[model samples]
Target: MSTATTQGGPELPQERRLVTEIPGPRSRELFARKQSAVPPGIGTTLPVFVTHAGGGVVVDADGNSLIDFGSGIAVTSVGNAAPRVVERVRRQVADFTHTCFMVTPYESYVAVCEKLNALTPGDHDKRTFLVNSGAEAVENAVKVARHATGRQAVVVFEHGYHGRTLLTMTLTAKNMPYKHGFGPFAPEVYRAPLAYPFRWPTGPDACAEEAAAQAIDMIDKQIGAENVAAVLIEPIAGEGGFVVPARGFLPRILEFCRANGIVFIADEVQTGFARTGDLFACEDEGIVPDIICTAKGIAGGLPLAGVTGRADLLDSVHVGGLGGTYGGNPLACEAALGVLETIEQDKLVERARHIGEIMLPRLEALKERYPIVGDVRGRGAMVAIELVKPGTTEPVPAGPIAARCHAEGLLVLTAGTYGNVLRFLPPLVMPDHLLEEGLSILERAISQG
Candidate 1:
């Protein structure tokens, strides 16, 4: 057995066994009930309701096991119901669910923060505060930056996704689903061009220097760097198509921010916690930020987020200024601690690199084989393929191909501003055979297209 599978320690058989159709009879029935009871705003990719999931496969309501490629949007990097996470969560839950960390804090919460402070990239003295979601972490990071600098304007990059809250929505570049019809967005948030090498207007070679220069120029002229509180961006763009900014792009932005005294905040929500081979994606370029926002893979499958930053920047805010009612709840904190342990002990960072080794070449091969595949890019488990019209740069919709994968028992996710990128975020704990099989399924779907 693979080390990852053994460490994830799933009791369920680690095999992709489709006993029935993808969205088998029971799943179809539940989805019907869901349609009537649940709000339409909540969208689902694969309609199969999961009964149990661990290791490489998710068993649906009808006992059909499917290969898990999405990892619940990169939240289950340690694997669903991972042994350590499950054990810790159970003990914490049995002891106490929520005393409201604000009302009565616990040692687990403090422990989780300590882990965050030590683990996140940076040798400087740091402090960490927990939150319920990535949006809250991001919102609070902005608050800290603004409070520390006494500045109003914030700069963000194009194709970067912060979150769905009002301020974060304004920070995000996508329109449909996230920002469409959601007007009256918060002000003082300005967008700048990202060094998206694949789609850069001036082409890939000049993307790094040009995009950085353009962003700095825009901030200086429009927003005025002196007036900017923070420059927030994802280390690897997540929902905006897993776009890794050009090699020199991030370092340049960091230099600009350092010169201007503007806080550089890395929203490492999707790309954090071994998803990008590095523990945090920012570490890949050695571009440490003043404030780092983390969520997704922080607590295994539990909902928890963290803002770990320089002691000076975070401490500048008032004592009462940076907390929430359920922020750092005991159960979630314990889960987070377990997640950290699993990552370190299981060596998931190396596993993520190995997954990249498995995925990138196969995806690159697909790009060479198919005209629709315009680009194949990403660092580790967080890889993607951008689809375009044959012989042109025009984007081709990824919906049909993704649906085909769903029908064939491969759970995949699509992203991109133009809805043309197929992103694959497989769990680090996945077995090798399943990874290869998932790729085969995707190849068939694309070949059909």
Candidate 2:
């Protein structure tokens, strides 16, 4: 790997290198060990074994360095091995790791919640609850919404992905991988069609209105609005191909929820904390959801998730109803504080916008060059290019193309319900030149295909 330098940071390598094959010898040995030790249900996106990471690069066990565009599925927005996060985590680990927030509350946990209440997109006085993962946060949100509103039904979009827990799995739309045989899911979860302009009718504006109308109509016809507790949606669908809804769609839905006394829940697990340019994607639509679910990038790379909402709504549940034993582990909380501070001090939000500016045009150029490039859409740095048949809009599973890219050392991820979308979630801290280099690799891989 050749060394390159950003403006002020330490110099790092620019090009990716393949020492052995894709997995290399060490990775194969580890894979065999993982297969025996790890659960069969858990899966890996890439076969490469990582040894260390920093900035935008992930170093593998075989000494090959690759640019990280996936960011651990949009978790490491502040970048892998961020200095601030590392320092804070090191200090926190020295002080304490866990005390069970429920048994003995700590200042760090409360401090993190304070940041969420202040940072999440809402002007009203808000409260927050820290959780272990995205699924736990979603489940707690449901519990709070149900307890506060005395309603049971939750409306989720058709292509939405909540989590793997029983209740969240029911809230999720996909079946094969997420819900496959996890049947008899939680009750009171309803699926509604989202405003997917690429597939459905209605222009951007009209699509938003039409989806809201359909949802309202369904609520009236099937489940009365009074019986519904919350309407959960992703500002930009994550696993569902980074689908950005039509203009005014979210606002219209928010209005419908307000009119019907239904809680509005924005699932920002994959789109929050500067991953999509803005600190929160809902800010783009000028819509403030009653409840906001966040994870992934909340703690840089730590496992932490939270649900922030209006103070009254969050406090509606009794004291004991909202906590877990390891809900807000001290180390994760400190890391979250560091992540938030870095986002502000380092100006990573604007950096994410810069990344978008650099990436969007390249993707557009690719779309013009290739007939299989059906659509390119995203906000800020969260972008995706969907693959389709030459003439028809039918999704084309270019998993092979992705595999080839992986073999060549560029790690990319495929999304969409049909597994045809190439989603990009590079760390916001990546240097512009490094990002361009990764994009060049992507273009070459696509061109060869």
Candidate 3:
């Protein structure tokens, strides 16, 4: 409840200051330069270029401080330029950057894996290997699963988002941006129904059981469980919308996986490392996944991911079968170690829960006041409000309202397959004042809409 004790490392002014209009002269000029230099395919959610950031605010090129509710798409949960992260990276960079884990190896890399094995859900002996991104981690997990199970089929859910790589694109559900013209995807990938209470034809009370049964049945009848390698899912769906599956959904799915001998992979890329009230979102169900793919918050702000799972499954693969050139880069590994330490020392897991305690009530209030807000759901700081038509579930485009928030110097983000959800991933270390101010801006934005 008290963020005054939060130390944002860089000693940045916690107060938000708007020196100019959004994307004022300097940022607009920078955007023009970026447009000229960068490819159009590389899109940006906002045109404001960041000059510096720390605590809960991002200072743009125009010297405007905007409250950051996005956390670089959930990358900087420990806060940007966290002291421990910077110190660790500084030491690692000075000594050496990369020696390639598979070749020379490093203690930080092994330490990171050890921490992951200890922190992730299950107690069984686990093995871990690092990767560059969430997509890469998912891909490698699938590879390990197939190799271990001697099966080829991988099942994902509708409204799920894996990544941008070809295989990940195949695993992802939505089209347009992720999987539109990029077809000729990997074969043997199957789709199942998500326990999305908001869109389920059945009501929430019976939705979990119904959807889980339907999904398992489809997989059994269509893909044949024996042929399946893994059932990959996000514990709390991310880009698919911050849709928390109904209570029994994940447990039912995990139960099915157990009976079928299928690997249950919890893709906690966006929800792991204290973003949720728990250390890992899957813990909320007491459902331990056979394989868990993690990234994003694993490192303070560094690019690093890992696949931790049952030792036998990971060990089943041949020696040279796993790992990447930069999979366990020393810098990223050190940064990850720092992140874990910060989480423990700062008690960020508890902080995330406290954030939820503050945010959920405010968001629920908004849902009640605004007809456009159809639902407000999420755990911890990972909260969102789904926008819809006045009296219906029909999506109301969220772009305009999010734009208003941006114009008012609040950095929020839009998610969901249909882009009708506004997700909040505020830093756990964010001061209560910033949190309340950001919410006020959001309320004004939704009101303007």
Candidate 4:
């Protein structure tokens, strides 16, 4: 009985049990229905449809409890349907659902903003506004930066993922899937090199100095520092394969933003809310940005995203400049409030550190045993292992390896622009044995391959 699996917590049993093969019969039937009804553009990572999930496992259509390592792509960090979140959302739903914050204000929305202000780094007077998704929040942040600075250019980094919308798609660096055939994207957006330590030409030690100098030089010569409105980056790159930029890379970039008048934005959609040990990943390096974009883990499992920044920068936007119909909906706001309370009360930040302690050594040992394991990196609970060719840096296909894990009961997610990294974002509240079980399953997958 691990401490993470409590007697009073999510009542579902905390173990992985397969009643049938991976997609079983019921899941296959549902998949048939899904294929008929849903568009092909919308893709799913796992084939089994979920019926119930809690603690550390997802109960699929066939009564099989599969170990969850994805956490709904980092949306359910507090664990699916956390008690506090459920209670708050249920109460809010019973009272009211959608009042449209723009039309009529509510306390929950303001309370969530207040939490964002207090929780996010920096002691400066801040203003927070809500949106329905990470893409919308990022779009709003860009709008504020451009308007406040009266500048036209925005700088992004290579191996970064913003979102799926027009501007965000332009901001995103990958091609093929995210941006293929969706060209003529928003202009004046520049992509600079990221301080990717694993692949940096100069090696890890010089990665920070070399990469930073190159990025700054490119922006200064090509984009002109004065014309750039913002430098948007992720403290820990998410969809780009959990790439943690080399040390000194972020600080130098932040320094450049401060010297110039560019708004420094940290998109914490995937790394915020205790997923990275600190409430936000920026805190890990003691770096705080002018504007912060947050979403994925903010509201337990509800849809909520926010842009919080210095009052001067955010307020510079004229009245009626920012908002949406479903932005900060009451139920989501209530759920966010519950999530904040749960983080503080449960001390999940420490739990993230514990998960890392348990995972890193095992993964590093795997790297020693398998030549295909190129690098094992990340912080807190947001860890990943990059796979490559036996004797070189070249990446081999990660799809087949992931499929092997899926064929068994373990649910894992693959990332990286090259598509050769396995990212693990387990719930902080998952029982220790389950986490141990997941690692074992992953070991089996790698060994078999």
TM-score for each candidate, following the candidate numbering: 0.98, 0.96, 0.98, 0.98
lDDT of 4 at 78: 91
Tens digits of per-residue lDDT for model 3, 226-257: 99999999999999999999999999999989
Residues 1-449 of candidate 1 have per-residue lDDT tens digits of 33333333446787777888879999999999999999999999989999888888888999988899999999999998888888898888888899887787789999988988988888899999999999999999999999999999999988988889998999999999899999999999999999999988889999999999999999988878899999999988999999999999999999999999999999999999999999999999999899999999999878899999999999898878989888998888988988999899999999999999999999999989999999999998999999999877899999999999988889999999999999999989998999999999999999998
Off by over 4 Å in 2: 1-14, 202-205
- Estimate, for each residue in 1-449, the C-alpha lDDT of model 4 and write its tens digit: 43233222446888888999988999999999999999988898888999888888888989998889999889999989788898888888899899899999999999999989988999999999999999999999999999999999999999999999999999999996999998899999999999999999878999999999999999999989999999999999999999999999999999999999999999999999999999999998889899999999999888999999999999999889999899999999998998888889999999999999999999999999988899999999999999999878899778888888888888999999999999999998888899888998888889987
Off by over 4 Å in 3: 1-10
User: Which scores greater on lDDT, model 1 or model 3?
Assistant: 1
Task: Return the clash pairs for model 2, or none.
Answer: none
Model 4 residue pairs with clashes: none
Query: lDDT for model 1, on a 0 to 1 scale?
Result: 0.92
How does candidate 3 fare on TM-score? 0.98
Clashes of each: 0, 0, 0, 0
lDDT of 2 by residue, 44-148 (tens): 888778976667787789888877889999988887767777788889898888889889888988999899999888789999989989989888888889999
In model 4, the runs with Cα more than 4 Å from the true position are 1-10
Q: 1 or 2: which has the higher TM-score?
A: 1
